[model samples]
Target: MMAFFEKLERKFGRYAIRNLMMYLTALYAVGFVISLVNIQIYYEYMSLDVAKILSGQVWRLITWIMYVPEQNVLFAAIMLVLYYSLGTNLERVWGSFRFNVYMFMGYIFLIIGAFILYAVYGEAASVFLLTPDSLNMSIFLAFALTYPDMTFYLYFVLPIKAKYLAFVYLLIEVYSFIIGGVITKVSIGLSLLNFVIFYLMTRNWNRISPKNVVRQVKFKKAVKMRPAGEPIHRCAVCGRTEKDDDTLEFRYCSKCKGNLEYCSDHLYTHTHVE
Candidate 1:
């Protein structure tokens, strides 16, 4: 899937929107204002009603995303700012093209999932209005997966890691899917399915390949055969091992494609292994 995305990038990269988050944030601002003034207008015209869609109100398919997820202005403001940052950072790391693909795929999934519900429940599905709530969650989940160690403030107070927060969210979503109605199950499943595919595509599958298996055997043998006093952890650059200084800390670079460790002194200074 990653390779397929790369192929698409090569072909359509020119059309990718730069500063895409800026546009999304602008729409969020519009939504926030609407929520402040008249939210009922959104439910009547903009909300995603599968029944209306099937009845030829197809514009609802896209306009529904324009409604702010939170009704409170303060909460809505926070959501807008939080997602804008997440979107921009993701675009920076993944490139404009891949970021666009990730976001648009999420939207596509929601649209398809809504239709699936309509098919299963018929006219009853109209009450299950899909919002951009799950889509925003996807953005946050993607950010967490890409930069798991990144820290966020909880209500501008306590500090928490992105991975931990995503875990809590996943648990909640799973519970909701298990206990809630058919619409909730379908919605949560589709959103989570998007994240699962993104996660799989981002992973280094070669680690489980036959060549890596052979290399692992060789690496283990080398580890055992080395001098007893030799340190197991060493920086890829500068060749300094833990044996050199007890205070020197080492960690694997997350941005690097493979397991490349670096000592604290060189961790941020050295070029990435790619």
Candidate 2:
């Protein structure tokens, strides 16, 4: 377990956002503007009218981000700000390009999942799961798990880690699913499913996301093979070769056989071949 964490830190240490998370915050700002206009057409549009998406009115998929539960501007603004703050951190760490890719994939997955549900269970499941109010909490849950240790001032009184709170949220959702019946369970199921899909795609498993690390290792190997103008043997203690222009001569260490090299200063002391 310790070795596993060490390797992960080495690879993904730079992925923690520095300032790019701000752009995610700004996306929420735009979300706020759309919310103010109260233009919630896509709730019905995406379900029954995806032809609009194919017809080049492509904003339906993206516009759904702006949908809010109530028409309360204050609540919308507050939630947007919070979403932005956490999301931008992820964006900065992952790069805007990768961040957009991840979010877009999540959206696409949700839409596809909705379409399947509609075909199987009809439009009711689509309306229940595809709406902005329904899906936003799933995005929040994703952000919470990514930064599990982050502290938030809950209701401006209780200081709690976001992940712990998110876990509690999940528990309630689970309880609702069990007691609240099929419609409610399906709602929670889709949200959890979306997160699982995204995590598995981005995870370090060799079968899932192998291309990124493979390219890096290939690049390092190419760097190691270049000669430094010296046809020389390698040192065993520290990996270096004697440069051709250097005054000290180097030869394979007799004591170490074909395994080591030594210069003149240590030639006698080190024991080497002529």
Candidate 3:
């Protein structure tokens, strides 16, 4: 796994467009500021209309991530903080490039699914066409799902896992599916699909092949290294240098030794009783 990741890091590098999660957070903040001045501007620019994404307005798929309704200032702020914290951690772990790829891939998949839905039901069938609320919430739901175990203080008092919170949010969306608006239902479905696609594509299971291959190569290289002329110091037990030198072939036993073979350091370290 380490080798595979190292190879990938070498190919992709630490700094790339993907590692710009911080930039995304900043852009989202700026979008909120501008949209607060005029909410309809967000709708016109950021929200991905079925027609727009399909008509090669590719930015629509990604720009929607920055779209937060002007009226929901507090809600958007809370969501952005959570996303920034988790996204930064994820970027550090995966490095910037991989995390960016992970997120953008999710966005791409969601857009593709939306396109398919449009093909089946026609452009107006999209809930996003009717309202942008569903689109905004999908981005939030995707981040929450990615780092579900992340804990946050509920009401600044109770600690709760984001996953549990996500579950509740999902349930709410389910209720919305039954009684909530059409756009709400579409958002819920797309958000869930986003999580599934990301989970599958970046999964550890798919990594096993590259990981094992790199390990095998490393093991082979290690086995091939010869144990060559390693320098040895005195072996105190017998008072002889284990290291071979060119000029001397000193033997240590009483029968062969003319001069006492003990190095000065070994003389005090051990006793040879006659």
Candidate 4:
């Protein structure tokens, strides 16, 4: 899966959008303004209605993303800011191309799920699949997975880890799916499929295992127990020993006159010794 993404990056990375989340947040803000003026207009034109979409109102396919989660104006503002932060961080961690793919795949899944629901129940599917709540939830889930230890203030009072919040959200979604109508159940499942597939593809089992933790501890102990002595190598130009900076890499200057050792920083820039 990583190989496939690498191939995609090589071929199409140049076209990937930078700060894609900022644009999405802008759309939500626009939707909010429209809603304040006349929510009926937004529902009639912007919301994802399969019947309308099938009957030549095809714009809903893309415009449906503007369906911001229902909340008060103050809360909505805070949530959008949080979402923008999450999106930018994910893009940085996963790279622009991969982040684009993750978001686009979620949109594609929602579209397919909408059509599938439409097939199952002719027009009623439109009523239940109105909002992009599932997509928003998936984004939160992704952020939690990526930065499990990050803390956030819940209601500007209590501090809670993002992973714990995500877990609570997951439980709520599970309950909703069990009790919700067919369209609701299907929407939840399809929206989460992107995160599920992504997690499976990118997770490293070894990093999370007990054996790896033990091995790391033993390695650290061995390093600490080593005899104290002068570093075997030192930079000729900088005169900084490896003991001072473990990250410093020493290399013999190939172009220099004798065997002159130079640190990585000065390896190419230093003049040749006579």
The CA lDDT of each predicted structure is: 0.79, 0.56, 0.59, 0.77
Query: Highest TM-score: which candidate?
Result: 1
| lDDT of candidate model 4 versus the reference | 0.77
Which digits, one per residue and each the tens of the lDDT, describe model 3 over residues 1-274?
4346546656876456754767877878987887878877766766767776667777876677666554487877887786677677656544566566566655665566666668777866545453334444544465565456557789889998777877877787778888866455565566667666655654545225675556547645754673566433334355355454332223222312222333322322234445
lDDT of 1 by residue, 137-246 (tens): 88999988767777899989999989999999989988998999876877788888888886686555656767767766876788898998889789998889978976
TM-score of each: 0.76, 0.54, 0.56, 0.75
The 10-residue segment with the lowest total lDDT in model 1: 247-256
Off by over 4 Å in 1: 210-274
lDDT at position 62, candidate 2: 63
Report the C-alpha lDDT of model 4 over 1-274, residue by residue, as the tens digit: 5456556777998898889998999999988878777878877898778889989999998888887656479978988988999998788766777688788888888888888778888877767664677877799899887667778899889999889999999999999989998767877887788889977765544444676566557646765876689465678877997788775556554335554667655653466687
Give the root-mean-square deviation of each candidate in angstroms. 5.8, 16.1, 18.5, 9.4
Please give the TM-score that candidate 4 achieves against the real structure: 0.75
Which pairs in model 2 have colliding backbones? 17-93, 20-92, 21-88, 21-89, 25-84
Say which prediction, candidate 1 or candidate 3, comes out ahead on TM-score. 1
- What tens-digit string does per-residue lDDT give for candidate 2 at 10-118? 5764664445446544655665565566445435443223444555757666665544555577776688777666666555434444455456555666666556666
lDDT of 2 at 7: 53
Clashes of each: 0, 5, 1, 0
